[model samples]
Target chain A: MNETATQTVVRLDRVGKTYGSGESAVHAVEDVSLELEPGKFFILMGPSGSGKTTLLMLMGCLLRPTSGVVYLFDRKVSGLGEAELPRVRRDNVGFIFQGFNLFPALTALENVEATLNLKGLRGEAARAKARDLLGHIGLAKRLHHLPEDLSGGEKQRVAVARALAGNPPIILADEPTGQLDSKTGRLIVEVLKDLAHNEGRLIFMVSHDTRILGLADRIFTIDDGHLKD
Target chain B: MVSIARKNLFHDKVRLAVALAGITFAVVLITVQVGVYLAFLANASVLIDHTEADIWITAHGLENFDFGRAFSEKKLYEVEEVPGVLWAEKYFLAFGYWKTPTGSQETVQMIGFDPETLVGAPWDIVRGNPQDVKYFNSIFYDEAETNRLGDVPIGGETEINNHRVRVVGITRGAKSFIQSPYIFTSFKNALNLSYVSKGNTVYILVKVAPGASVEAVKQRLKETVKDVDVYTSREFSKKTRDYWMINTGTGVALLSIALMGVVIGTVIVANTIYTSTTEHLKEYGTLKAVGASNWHLYKIILEQAVINSVLGFGLGMFVSYWVIQVMKRGNLQVLLPWPILAGVYVTTLLMCLGSSLLSIYKVTKIDPALVFKS
Candidate 1:
């Protein structure tokens, strides 16, 4: 791995998250500290209801940590307001969801272009970049296909292209291959691993697919909101 | 951003059509209701608008043009003598019953003007001449009122206030809001039929000289005339319209119907837009997770609203134009003036944007983190 401690893209210090309140409260994540660096595939392995998704959300700035700080590229974000978090995510983080989460209304190319548009890149330049990214993912011929028309693997690939559209340094994927067949899921994992190794990007993924664990440079397991190295 | 909004709105063709239909229905309802009310107001002052007179002198405390107590004919002479007054003529108006050939009684507003000058006469004569009414007991009846007046054809005979009268000419587009057909005649004939004395008249129609100021002439007429109200033609027309539209319950009724149309339209638009937004809730959540701001989501919804409003407004205007054509064939005046058309367009946009507020709130409050769950 080319990653170093000094090259951390995300740092969580004693982070904790709880849902609901008082006696009915569910502690989704307990006090945990970790650092993610670039140029390596990092796996967050856990069983169901193990708080892996919640921790990913905290790192992605989609949720605020209940008690502790989240640092993205050395800037404290847990204390940021709702309005400020989207900018932090837009500039530094990209998200890939379990169900592919491609916009059903947009074509494959358009789904990727939409993310570029959020970053204020538009017109022919955005279109060209989206086309190139789709081609890079071997989906050049499916550019005009909507989410409903594409296969599960194709949909996830489009989602991946969308995630990389803004060239964000940190890619946070939550079970991106969970809905695909084993063969298709393996292909997706290889593509993500290539992005992490060749492009020097950090691929932080949460998955239950143990088959891809051998490919991870580092791995952490979570059980009932507690993380174990 | 705009492209995404457009694609999303157009993604489901059926939903888009249904939404546009809702907006179009709203536009049509509001525009048609308002158009009909405007037409009603215009009809209330139709005679005043078509008349060539500059000043109208009526009895003191005259409320509207439809009803006025007769003043002395001497008022015409006094009004004619005003410095800026070019000419003044005695004009008479009264409501009397007309006996049809079948002996059925129908109310008619009798308008009497001098045949030679032809001032204050119905200008759109479909058949025959205004001068023909100068013949004794001869009258001009509006052809548009054939349905109500039982076809008083040219040269047909009818009784006005029990006096035999001949329809010498047929006028067009002169129907009144009171649902009373207008009967045009010479000054003497109108007075004779209404049982008014020879020396009395209902109004004195005045014309200002070429170089004279209408306001100056009005002031002179007010000073010269006694126990009479003198008003410029525009002011008198407005008063008549206001009386029919405000004091009478007709205006309130029409306005209330128009307002109801607006409310119903707003509800339909709100419901349709809210439904569309809810259907796309998951997609919106995904967009947010991909780093889109609340403002971005709001822009998308607003764009959808604007598209729906503009297209719906265009369709509504097209439909209203056809409706007006049909109304004209039936002899009903429906005026869709450009200003009113513009007003309706702006109103449609406002209605659509206002309707999207709930959907905007719902979309903005969506949790972006939900995209993570399977």
Candidate 2:
């Protein structure tokens, strides 16, 4: 376990994020330092305006930190240009948003296939991979359903399948259960935990629900843009 | 993968219908306007094109074939004696009033030619033979003029310039540019009906000998026949068409309307595509976040535009063909040559592609971060 901890998949060295400049500047995240390893589910708990989502975005490579450095897989990413960030995110991270973010026009199967296409998997290979992923998430029966036709829990399951498409090493979920009932929320969290514990992938989730605290292997509490040990 | 471009365009059926309708309207407007303009030019030079003469000798300062001035008949003999002139004949043309049997009068173009040679004679004769015009005071009237000429029968009698004449033959498709019906007669009878004297003629039609060059013969005729313009048939036809195309504002008006259609179609496409892009902006951001490049996004928008253009152009051509058929019944000529059809297709494509730029610009400005917030 000590050897595994030394191999950090994601590291933030004294990272900070500030919006705007001069008098109207807002310090969203201040001097936060952390290291995350594979095969563990880590959760960040905070209230609104606490910068929990901003910190998750920085880890997912969706947002660049205004100050300090962000390292992913031991590669420096905070210094990379905007044009190079998307490739890093595509190869390393998968995002599950609160809204489920499935294309409204495409079916569940098509949504997952689209992501696989981005990963350069197309034709029969992409189709087979998408089907296998959806089936793994227990959505084989609803493969043809559109987002509008699916229930809230089912939509989240499809989103989970999309996030698991390329089998990325890192999974970033921003309030994945914010819009779900307690039972459905637990079901989604259990599936995410399985991917971390059984598949040895990194699961980094941001949420304010204390109910999920028992399922997390590690938890960090943020208040007023600062993290507490 | 999936054809996201096709899916996005087809998802909103209502918007697609509106865009197609706008493009179809522009195509119809442009086709009809330009078609009529081309038809008018064709009609202006119809007689000159149909004549078998290789060279036309008209009075100097001739504006067009329809407005020929009477030159001396002696130029016919001089033209015949030219080095390359195989034969020369008198052809008379002048405007006259035709008093119907019911005493109603309508203006008509009186054309005179030799019946034996058959040069400058009315073709597609439906009622009587060309030799029938050789009879005393015999003439021919076009069947297309039935509306204005009151459907005169084969032996029908009418008065031209107050002189009584019989309609010995009925010709078809000898339409005039100014909508005046053509009345055909022999040179002897035309001299008695019109104001021109027997020794004067409107034009001298000359044929170039097979072994002689028309240009050299034309030059010789130019020197031999003074105070006259000698032109080949093609040159005369072009000159006549250009006279009407430039002097009359009809050409400019038609072209302006056609250009207006292009502009209106572009605006319609731009507005509709822009609105569609704005509505689906969130989906675009999601695609951006999921590893789609800017080029991929542009392909989606531009592909939608090209599909709209092709579908609309096909439907518009169908409607234009139907309208042209309907106009033919009323003798309103509208021609869609192959070149014009191909030109319209390209124009439609360009209009739609150009209009799609507005939507592409909007998509380029979208920030992928908005997807997480919304």
Candidate 3:
């Protein structure tokens, strides 16, 4: 890798986030400092209750760092107001969850279109964007299918399409393939890898699959609220 | 945004159907009670309205409708002779109970009108005609009393207060006070039967000359007759209706019932919308995480609530007006006044908005980190 290409898109400095207070307080993320650069396929691995998820959320500007600073594109995030975070999430960051996934009631095309529509696109424009995303994700034919009708792989693909609908610069995906079998999980990883590779987007994911780790440009292991070297 | 809301409403049409059913049921009760009350008010003024006369000359006191009377029935001829008076008809009203041969007694309002003048008759007969008008001494009653008075053959006699009378014809839909049928008879027939003073009646109903205002005639009559009160048809009809509207406890009773319906509708809308959003809490979070601004998600959920409110309102109005086939601003009593309808819509919309705000809790407090490790 060229040293000049490691320019940081996301940076966390001495970030510590604690829930509760005093003796009973629990530190979810402690003194975590990391940099995620553009076009980097980064993986955060951890057991349950580890700070890995917290770190990604901090990078995505969803959660504020407790004691230090976080910067997205050189803009200070830890000091951002509550109202400002929504714009940050909408225009710059994308997220994927594991269990509570796509809005189950909306059709696949609607799910992708809803993201663009939320960003203030009109109905026709949003639909066009959503259809293009679905077509790119190989779900063009299943545009009208609801989540219940979609298999695990198809649902994840819809989720990915939804994430990219707004063309956010950073995609922060939770274990998007956690619920899928090995073959489907590999397919999801390939799609995400393509987004990072061809599109030059920063793709940060929390995954349990070590098989996909080989595809990551960088992988960090986290355990019990601390990063493991 | 609105389109999203409408599509979402269509998405779960079954749930929408269920919610709309609740609103419709409430409207049924509301319209029925309101319609019946208004129908009663309309029936109260039927005798005066059917007279189609311009001016009423009653005793100075004008205490109760049945007990009011002028000093003379001759006053009818005098009013007819007055300048600009086209004609005058003597009208009498009384309240008495009819004890049938079956020993069942019903209280009724008795109306006496002139057959020659054709001033007050069973004009709006639904089932029968006033062919009985030829029999001056016989009585014609509305059909509602037919069940009690028996299908009176034209020649059959019934004892009404120990006096023998011939039954003429059964009126179609005539009920005064909405409980008892009004009994219509000739001027002298009702006078002697109800023990009214000889050659004297309760009031004089006068029809003025063309291009004459009823209020002007009323002012002229009251000026000419010092010891009597003159009222226009609309004025006296409203007076009689107000008498019953206040005395019979209809205002408080129907208002309370309608208020309850509105409250119930608000609660149902609020709870249903709030619960629906609660179920979609995580879904909202996922949307927020995926390039959805707080306002954006809020617009969607709020659109859903407003859609529910509008749908419920449209259905409620339909069921309310369709039941009695009554128009809103017509003579019908189920008045959906502008304020009431507006209040309902505004409050319902607020309820929906308030409930959907609960879903914003999910959006704001949602830790995108919670689902990180899956």
Candidate 4:
């Protein structure tokens, strides 16, 4: 890997997020600071309502912090306006959800192509790139199938392909394998692992499934809005 | 991206059909109301438009063509003496009760003109020669008036104002604006059948000689003729049309109905689009989470609205065409000029675009983090 490709891409400075105010407020994340670099698979393990998802959202620029700051690719993003956040998110961050969240109306290939289009790739070029991503994840034969028509494993693989579109520097997965069987979940983790190690991407996943913890380069745990390494 | 707007709209066929139906109903309602309005105005001036006269001399302040006021028959000679006047003829119009053969009485508009001059003769004569009205006690009945006149056949006898007359000619396309049938006859016959006295006429029709200015002739007649309104043929027709449209309740009623159609259409289309957008809130949230901007979502909804309006307008015009054709068979005139058609299309587009505003607002306010929920 090149010297710059292995550098830290995301940094958090005493980040905190609280919902509501006064006596009824609930703190979802609290003063958790960390630096994440490329070419490594990182895992965040937490029980329900433990704020791992909140931390992931903060890093992805989906939620603004109540205190402290966030930086993506060495640039501060915490103070950016709502209108300016989408461009930074589009160019750097790709998210994978537990439910797949593929547009129900779009076929598997089109789901990936839509994301590529958001990144300014269009027409046949978007199509070819989407096909190559899905093919690499072993979904080449299921390109035309809708989400409802695909198996759980196939759907999750398509979601992975979508996250890899536009070659975002960071991939955030929230319980990506939460809905899959053991064998399929392992295969997905392996695919994500290959993306982080070989393609030099920063793969940050939030999950309670400890079976794949052995594969992660680093692991962190969260409890009641606090983080620990 | 893959025509997301089109695919989203076409995905649910039932919703799309309902949306189109609302817009189509509005288009038909507006078109028919305006069509009838235009037809009523056209019929109000039909006599003035079809006449061969270059100028008309009417009693001062005559309201419309149907409501005639009598001026002295001597005004014809005054108009004929104008420098540009080629000739002039006396014409009379008044309402009289006609006793059908079944003894049922119906009101008719009596038109009197000189048969030799044929200055204001009934057009589209279907049965007999127009000149046949020159015979004494002879008149013309429109073919469409058979139901109201008790099916008067050729050579049939009828009584107008207690004066006996024979139907010597059958005319078509002469339906009056006020739902009264027209009775065409010679000036002498009309004088006997109507309440007008001898040597008194309602109007004097004048023709300008070749290469003569009609405006100059009209001005000279206005100056020479006393206590009468002198107008060119176009001015007289416009006056007649405006009288019916502004001075009567019919115009107000039709315009009100058209305005109501627009309001109802906007509400229906807006409701449908808003409901569809709400139902797809999860999908929209997902798009936002995937970095789709607010404008991208708005474009999808706006495209759907435009598609609905275009398709609905086309279907509405097709139905309106058939409706007008059927109304014609019943002797009801509904004009569909090019301007009216183009106006309806533009109105439909604007209406649908306005309706899309509510849906766009709903989609743009969504929370992108909602997609995080399993």
Candidate 5:
């Protein structure tokens, strides 16, 4: 990989999103333009209803742009047909939620293994690969333990391992540490920064947590749907 | 994937147990009722079961097993002279009631057969002798009905059609539909009570000679016996069963409706499982967040439904067998064949899968980002 000129991995051009209709319509995101490079930790900050989550969803390709275009690997994803978007999201994006999202019934390893299974892996091969990732995240002992059995920090680590398991270029985390205590939150952020700086992942986290601001290489704000510098 | 579906079911012990219990109840209800229906159909042909005769020569217009038209015994001689010749016995089947001395009335299927041929006597008699039935106007009552009547004395006379009839023997399982206690008498006594003349009987039973094919014998008898129908024992039984289950709408209709109860139970299985998935929507969201697709989620849900169906079906069949056994002791008309039980199980599985389909859809449709937002 060429260090500085690795090319922009996430770019949004004049993207607008309007929800509802007539007098009831709401413009959730409006005319937002941005670019995200590899090996950087970025923060999308806003108060509630400021469309921070909406913008993040749009950037993750989990939601379509109501207007304009989204370029990831220079494919112009927004203009692509409906059928092609899910594949793009599956292959290129990883998502983390505030609740430390994990299927409660599955073991930590099984939870990570679900990724490859969706990517069409099955049997001992999926389990073996999941085990390797869990080992990397220092969760080998808790590999067979379900989410309820793991501590908040342990769960977040498992979630992180799951995001990195598929080797997706972009990891979109929505308030990834909001449920954890301050110390655990800091540890969670540290792991996320390692994904961005060391592993050359583009980590875009949406949050209002002030403690997270200094850790980000670039900070973008969405206030009432428009980008705020 | 199937392992995951199973794991999800066991994640909550109480939920799984409750769902299993519902399914079990549905299974038992379906199997037992269907068993009863089948038994009723078989029991209606008990006369055919007891007769050693291969062909029954009944009136030409007869449509019922026990209560068809009676005719002159001359038809017996006609059937006797047919090619592949077989001997014939005259028998009478009539419905009447016997009054206990205390005035408690028990209905009966009064059977009269020639004493010389001794055709279609009770297969098992617990008291006295079959020869005792030779006592003109003497009758045989089943052991169950006898006990039900507070154990009446063996030599006592019960009033039949207002005439004194001696109870010469106690039999077992010779009873008729719920109300009818069975009684066997001599042909002379039957004609006397039925007010019929000599050389006239309700039916003529024909048995082929040892070397003759039974079907050929039946065909010959039919050809020789004019205006009269002669059928093999199996054909006669089928005709009788069909009379009850098919020609008449009563038994078959009731049984088929009862079987649909299983279908209803399967629907409940689907609803509850689907409802549970909705209750755990966020978990699916989490699955999606971790990179699981809708298709992956759907596969497990379908597998979970199948597991529930198979378990429910197995438990139900066991319940049905026990029920059939108990009914047999009650001497109820309830049959539980392997084929019918298998059909019930397969139907139950389809129902289980049908019910769980919606749950699978709901789980698969969940957006992974919902977990992150919440």
Candidate 6:
């Protein structure tokens, strides 16, 4: 993906994120800079404790950088207040977690509709949209099933549908296939790859799964808070 | 948003039941305690509440009707001479002992009034008639006191203060809080049984003329009758109730128990809400990651608290209604007025909302970044 031709959805400029202070202070991410453009599957690959999740969080605008600037679609969000950060994330960014963090009490369709509700969509319109998103993720028959009733792969698919409910320009996923079997993990990666290529959405994911590396357009490795291309 | 809140609350039926139980227990405890206290106050002034007199003249420094000395009967003559005083009668009240058939003695409050005018007489006679007291040694006994008074049948004789008295009538719903059975008789017979000398009375019952002001009549009697206290019926009733409730520590004790019920309810509700919030902390983090604001989270929790409060309060009131009915059957007056019920409902709602504060604080502080970790 050429940066000059395509639009840049996420950019991190020499960002540093530190946790705690004094003797116990830990630098989670240091001097990490990157730009992600639309229509590409970008992967942040690292071992455990390599700060991949922290970098993803930083790029997702869920965490503030201790140094340098972070921008989402040319808007600097690293310095935004608590109230403003959520608006930027909700309007432009969608997230998927490794645990498939669906509300156990809500059904799959209701879980997807929750995101639409957060976006101020309501009534039958939101329900129809949620149904379509679940159907697109191959979970049309499982829409009314709860997280506890669905298999792990089905739960991850519901999470995918929920993340896509808002139709944001960028999707940030952290080890979304970590809890699935190899066959299911590959299928999940295929769906995400198709979303980036066909839907023209920027996709950023962090994982240690080498088996899925062939599917990424670009890969960046992080170790001990340092990034390497 | 409300659907999510409803689902979360109904998901765990056992937890929901436990939470409702705690709230119901609190409501019943507080309501019953307050009900009993109100009933006690009502009973303390039962006579003053039911009497037909407009004014009462008692000896000076009389705190209540129970413990007061008899004043000279001549005060009634002076009170009758006051303007607006239509008529007046000497009434007698004194504590005396009655010997039961089993050789056990029971305390009795001997009330004496004019048999001709029937002023200050028992109005709830279940058997016989008020005029029957005109016979010598004739008296009326409360039906509720049949057990303590040895089931004295109508037209039966009993020994009161070593003076033989015949029970010619039975009264209903006239039980006193002091646990002393009331014996109604003629003024002469009461004086004889109480061992009081002739020409003295404990209270002077006065009636005001039609369209006349009771307060004005009370003032006139106070001025004309020297060294005696004059009070309108309402004023005396309040004074009597206050004397027993506030000065005697009964009000404070019952009120403290009721307040304790509120405190216990609040704590139980708060603990339950906090636990539920903690259990769902991860889901909240996911919601934040999916773009839910702090306000959205707050609305969900507030809805949960409100739903619990309404349902639990309804159940509590139902239980309290049954408890009050049981008490009534036992001849214990439990007054559950509409105002008290409304006040308790509002307080219970507030208590449920107050309990959600801790949970709201915890939820609002959940880090959305945690969703990236797992």
Q: Which candidate should be chosen as best, given TM-score against the real structure? A: 6
* TM-score ranking, high to low: 6, 1, 2, 4, 5, 3
Candidate 4 on A1-229: residue-level lDDT in tens?
Answer: 3344857799999999999999999999999999999998999999999998899999999899999999987799999997988888888888888888877778899989988988899999999999999999999999999888999889999999998888888999989899999899989999999999998899999988889999999999999999999
**In candidate 6, what are the lDDT values of residues B1-374, reduced to their tens digit?**
32787898898888889889989988998899899999888888887778889988889999987775898998877888999998888888999999888879999999898888888888898998888887888999899887788888888898998888898999986778787888899888899889787889999988899999998888878777899999998888988889988999888898888888888888888888888888888888877876778988898889888998898899999999999888776767787799999998898999999999999999988876666656
Which ten-residue region of model 6 chain B has the weakest summed lDDT? B365-374
Give the TM-score of each candidate: 0.89, 0.88, 0.78, 0.87, 0.82, 0.90
Question: Among all windows of ten consecutive residues in candidate 3 chain B, which has the lowest summed lDDT?
Answer: B327-336
lDDT by residue (tens digit), candidate 3, B1-374: 22545666676767677656655555555555665666667777777777788888887777445455546777766677667677887777766678676777767667777777667888766544464554745888876566655566666777666677787666755666545557888777778677667878788878889998777777777766667778888788888877777766775687678667656755666566666666666777777665566776677778887777677767877776676565423324343446656766675566556656666666566665544434
lDDT-wise, the better of 4 and 5 is: 4
Provide the lDDT at B302 for model 4: 91
**Interface DockQ of candidate 6:** 0.57
lDDT of each: 0.87, 0.86, 0.73, 0.87, 0.78, 0.87
A229: Cα error in model 5, Å: 4.5
Local lDDT at B43 for model 4: 82
| Per-residue C-alpha lDDT of model 6 across residues A23-123, encoded as one tens digit per residue | 99999999998888898998889888888888888887788989989998888999999888778888878888898878888999999998899888898
Off by over 4 Å in 1: A1-6, A20-26, B52-55, B60-62, B71-88, B96-106, B124-129, B146-173, B195-197, B206-235
TM for candidate 1 is 0.89
TM-score of the A chain in model 2: 0.96
Model 4 TM-score, all chains together:
0.87
Q: Chain A TM-score for each candidate, in the given order? A: 0.96, 0.96, 0.95, 0.98, 0.95, 0.96
Which window of ten consecutive residues has the lowest lDDT sum in model 5 chain B? B284-293
**DockQ score of each predicted structure, in the order shown:** 0.58, 0.47, 0.45, 0.52, 0.37, 0.57
CA-based DockQ, model 1: 0.58
Better of 1 and 3 by TM-score: 1
- Alpha carbon lDDT at B157, candidate 3: 77
* Runs of candidate 5 exceeding 4 Å displacement: A1-5, A79-86, B49-63, B75-89, B96-106, B113-197, B205-239, B246-260, B289-293, B364-369
What candidate 3 gets wrong by more than 4 Å, as runs, is: A1-7, A21-25, A123-125, A222-229, B1-14, B48-90, B96-107, B114-135, B138-175, B197-200, B203-239, B309-374
**Tens-digit lDDT track of model 2 for A97-197:** 88888777788998899888887899999989999999999999999988899998999999899888787888888889988999999999999999899
How displaced is residue B286 in candidate 4, in Å? 2.8
Best-matching candidate per DockQ:
1
